[model samples]
Target: MDRVRRAARRAMFAEKPAWQRWSLRVLMTLAWPVGAVTETLYYLSVLPPDEIPRRALAWADRGGDMLALAFSRNVPPREYYTYRLHQPDRRAWITACLYAPESYPLLSWLNRRNGADNNTVQDKSRFADLCRRHELPCIATLAVFRDGSQLWPATPFIPALPLLWVKDLSGSRGAGAARWRLDAGHYHNGDKQMTFSPEALARQWLPRDCLVQPCLDNHPALAALSDGTLVDFRVVTGIHRDGWVEVVATLGHLPCGGPSGRRYIVGAIDRNNHCLISPTLSGFQIIKNHPDTGAEITAQPVPFWPAALELVVNAHKKVPEFSRFVFLGWDVAITPEGPLLIETNSGWGAFNHQRGIGAPLGWTCFPDIVAEYLDFSEHGDAACD
Candidate 1:
């Protein structure tokens, strides 16, 4: 019965014209509020009954203005705050309410402009070219291109490099990233062996245009935390009111160094932005030691923290097209030479930051942050909202 139902759905979907299918997707995206309500109910179901009223009061106190604003815009308050209730901290829910799409006009506008296909900063190949042209310190990335049915490597290779990371130019969260290693008489991608023939590889990896680069050797400070897995600092930066770029939040994600890759044991960065310590699973559980090696990560100093911040700031300034984004998430690797740019995220996720600190972002405290991004002054006194 399940197979028949699945086949029927697939046949129906395939019968639709491409334009019709795309239109349906767009409509579904626009109707996120409906799905948001369903999600909120699921979280509410898991909460303790005795503490519900107390948490509700806190939510009202912290997210009242934002919630009211959302309601006025025909967006339900629960639609915005639902998923956040799963967090141990009640503040996460309030923060989500404060930044809900209906109330935060700037978020909606930015989403329309730079979300999905519109965002170029997420393009790994394009970003590598930018870095090369600007002479910024970054890994040498070869952009793979497709010619007819054949895919070609961007640069000549000796077939003996120790390691390479093949990444989808438009992928994120390490989903499209794959590691290749030169082994005895054969090439290996993770555990699978690949044919040495270029044509074989091209046929194997369809829909070309990938960015290939040498695997980054972790700096000693980061390596100490998570053996060989690449540990990086996620730096959140935004344009400040005074017309200067500044770091808003910084955190570290240490991998457990196994098949469960990039699933980090999150840590809180110090006020100085130079050290990471007191690892936690998004404020849900305290992680005292590395899951793989049992090494302590608490109160560890990250080497060359100041330089990493400066490099990120310079990189952000070079991209004028991304200025409208206002907020960017940067994955930075601290190498022995200096800091290297791993990638930049326009639609950066908030799970790690919110979970790591277990606190609300500045949405409620500073309503002007959203106002400034929206250019509210030109829109005529958005102060009333």
Candidate 2:
């Protein structure tokens, strides 16, 4: 029963080291209040002052209860009224919390027994190996290092490759990710500079588990969109019980050259997964032209859209360990050859896609993922439609 599972989870959490439990509790306590205030402000911005109290009461009656409404901002009253009222009980509110980016620590802990290995997805070296084994088109690794020591039987660095990317195995948001050219090395973290070095590069810049891979010369079509910087498509997907893979949502992150170089420009995708319009940072200030090259990407066609979808769906099916992740965001690059796997993300941020877009998780696919999981927790039925 769901009650039994919750009790067991609480016991397991209590058994953890006191420091670890205390730290996690502190994080949840701190984040909950912030999320509550922020969500309240969001509702106030969109709703009438007099309607707020009525809406709050409705949310509580629907299973938000007192603690759920006060501690979590994953679901607002408006969203529940709009998209979740059809479901019985407060299932939708529970669903929102489980998938919220802020709840990752708790969700990962609860689902750890399901065999999700976030480190495998975080480490570029390990992820690259997974791609190679699956015969997926991916950036080839030239060398790998750990703690300042070179890994044996390396992939052989090519002196004439023109560009090499140095990455921290566990880095995110481009932290510690860098590009090395014949002239200078470019770090994505604040654009720091370093001279290229095969022997000492890892120690100097990386200083941790690191990997070197040849820079991908993106397909000409993709290059035109961002003036040659690698353009990554964030394709979020889910897998169903009947072995069907579904594309949940897709967005594009086009980096354009600024005075220094182009910063990340995020954009929503059209129905066909093409760039909808001039990409914008913060979902405002439409960029009609590239800052450096002045090329227009508004409504630009994304080459091989169908092939890319197939590749990602198949890639998801190949990794059983990843099955535990009900939702995942895959970073895919369009190359001259075809679609290439850049990286996989279990904890993808929703702000870029959902910030200005007023919709719940199920609006795109309408899959009752939370309902399916709840049934499984209470009835031991894992099958989902």
Candidate 3:
């Protein structure tokens, strides 16, 4: 009976026309408000007794404003506070929610129109191969594992490196990422040690497809700012209508020691001079010096700034396949040799940009660029909404 019901539902969905399917998706997208309100209530419930009343009052006061923004600007209710949109001055800033692929069908359509069809930037293994083919500066993949079996290095032995970094091939936001260190001829990963042969350990440790690469160190000038992990920069670039690529914004991922060990704080970089400024904790509170190292974040300009910028811009131009992506966020590492490409993001979040700069992108020329690329006339005001 259950199988029959499932089959009927599948057939019903497949029988629907394209327009009806699209409308269903739109309806589902519009339902996020209920989830958003539920999330806000849950957050308030967890607050201390005295804090709940104040926070709840704030939420209530912003109810009208939240609804207006949602209808007019397409900002999700939860993002209103998450991006600090309640501040009158910040009202003009666009929320990251506006570009979420799940919620905004127009942007999703634009992504496909712009060349997302062949986008390999999201897959680590494929991206590495693309970079290598183009002679682009990037970390080389040592080996690949899939389903607890070796898929690369035909001989199937782990590379003999002092340190190695393992990451899910298609994961993001540092999910399922870990570092392995060679200690006493054995690999140590947190509390787990490589007690078996290297081949056996690789199979045991990896349950999903992943890539293994050598762990890199921060350039000496910026080493102190990094609590012991490699710190990378998030460089955003966009291709204009005329086929020229430009750097839009830059942010630094500074590593700091936390109770759990190493964590990162994002800071806005002076686009012109490449100096770190306006560092923040979780995009909320402004921070001055590194909490763990006490190194002044803005003390010195970032090393290899020009080279880093050039690497990404040139990469966009050199790879014709990537030209379809109007915007890309590049994760670049600075090494003694120069800047190395870490990865590329086709759908980068705007939270870091707005929080680091303390302004909405709407106030800048970003909207104009997007509107032009998307050709807003076809979709009318609905695209903006």
TM-score of each: 0.70, 0.70, 0.82
Per-candidate clash tally? 1, 4, 1
Error of 1 at 216 (Å): 0.5
Tell me the lDDT of model 2 at 253. Answer: 81
lDDT measured at residue 94 in model 1 versus the true structure, 0 to 100: 44
Worst 10 residues of 3 by lDDT: 1-10
Tens-digit lDDT track of model 3 for 1-385: 1121122122222335867866765775578577656655554444435434456567576666666665565555556655656666665555432323222233344456576643388788888888889999999788887777777878866556888888888868876787777766777774463354465557655677888999998889888778778889988787877778877677898888732566677887887777888888656557788887888888868889999999999988778766677777899999888999999887666656766665555545555556555433432432222
- Among residues 3 or more apart in sequence or in different chains, the pairs in candidate 2 whose N, CA or C atoms overlap within 3 Å are 256-262, 257-262, 258-261, 258-262
Quick one: best lDDT, which candidate?
A: 3
Extract clashing residue pairs from model 1: 282-355
- lDDT agreement of model 3 with the native: 0.68
Please give, for residues 1-385, the per-residue lDDT of candidate 1 as tens digits.
1121122122222335778855764775577556555544554455445435466666444354334433343334443343344335553454343233322333334434333233457677677777778877888754354433323353443345667677776777786777776656555776564545443443444566566677887887677677476788888776544446677667788876565453567765776646666577434456787777777777567887888888877776665554545667888888888789887886555545655544545432223444453333442433221
What does candidate 2 score in Cα RMSD to the true structure? 7.3
Alpha-carbon RMSD, candidate 3: 7.2
The number of clashing residue pairs in model 3 is: 1
Error of 3 at 141 (Å): 1.7
lDDT string, candidate 2, 45-109, tens digits: 55434434466666444434323544443344434433333255545434432233333443344
